[model samples]
Target: MLTAKEIDEQLSILQETGRKISECFSSFGSRMDFKPSPEKWSARQVLHHLTDSEIVLAYRLRTLLSENQPKLKAFNQNNWSATLAPEQEELPLMKSCFEANRNLTIRLLKKIPASLWEKKGVHEEAGEMRTYDLVVRNTSHCLRHLEQLQKLTEASQAVKL
Candidate 1:
C-alpha cells in the first residue's frame, strides 16, 4: 500500500499534468484541433476528454473515501468527445480546467486519512475498485492521453516537413 506521503506526491504530479501537456503542445495550438484521420481525436479533444475525466474521477474518488460499497457510474469517453465538440473550445481553456479540477481533487485527498485508501467501491465497468486503484488509474489515464497527444504531434511534425 502506498503511504499518504507517497500518494500526496502522486497527487502533486497529477496537478501539474495540465501544465506539462500545455507546454508540450504549445507549438501545436494552431493545429491542436487537427485530426490525422476521421477516427482519431485531436489534441484539443484529448484535453477536453481529460478535463471531463478529472471531474468524473474526482467525484468517484470522493465516493470511495466517504461511502461504504459505493456503486460508481460508467461513462463512454468516446461519446463525450463526440458530443462535447471539443474542437470548438480553446485549447488553453481546456487545459486550465483540467488543472483546476485536478487541484480540487488533490486538495481533498490531502485531507483524507491514510487508512481510507483501502476503502473499496463498485465500478459499473471495472467491478471492485479501491481508493488506491483510483489514484493509480488517474496517473495512468493522464499518461495514456499524454502519449496519444505526443503521437499526434509527431504526425503533424512529419506533415510539416
Candidate 2:
C-alpha cells in the first residue's frame, strides 16, 4: 500500500510527463515519426498512446473511486497505434489532452478518502489490482513511455519539414 504522500508524489511525476513529452515533440519535429527500429514506436505514436492511455486510466481511476471493484476493460494498444497516424504531427494537441486528462484524474484522486485507495478492481488481463496498485503501475507506465519519447528524440535527428 502506498502512503497518501507517495501517491501524491507519483501524481506529480505523472503530470510532469506531459510537459516533458511536449518538449520532446517540439525538439524532434518531423523526426517525431522516426522509428529507431522497424518494430519500435515513433514519438508521435507514443504521444497518441499516452493520450489514449490517460483517457482510459482516468475512467478506471474514477470507477475505482466511485464503484465497487469495477472490472477494467483492456484494449489492444497495437491496434490503437496502427490507427493513430503518427505521420500526422499534432504534438501540441496530443500533449494538451494528455495533461488535461491527468489533471482531472489527479484532482479526483486527491479528493477521495485515503481508505478508498484499497478499492479492488479486476483487470481484464492482469486479474485483481487495487486502486493504489493501478495508480502506481500507470505512474511507472507513464515514466517508461516518457523515457521512450526522450530516447526517440535524442537518438534520431529531427527531420526537416
Alpha-carbon TM-score of each model against the true structure: 0.88, 0.87
What is the alpha-carbon lDDT for the whole of candidate 1?
0.80
Residues 81-144, candidate 1, lDDT per residue (tens digit)?
A: 8888887787667667777777778778778877887789999988898887877788888888
By TM-score, how accurate is candidate 2?
Answer: 0.87
The 10-residue segment of model 2 with minimum total lDDT is 152-161
- Model 2 global lDDT (CA atoms, 0 to 1): 0.79
List residue ranges in candidate 2 displaced over 4 A. 158-161
Provide backbone clash counts, one per model.
Answer: 0, 0
Q: What lDDT score is found at residue 132 in candidate 2?
A: 82
- Name the 10 consecutive residues with the lowest summed lDDT in model 1: 18-27
Task: Please give the TM-score that candidate 1 achieves against the real structure.
Answer: 0.88
Residue 94 CA error for candidate 2 (Å)? 1.3
Root-mean-square deviation of Cα positions for candidate 2 versus the true structure, in angstroms:
2.3
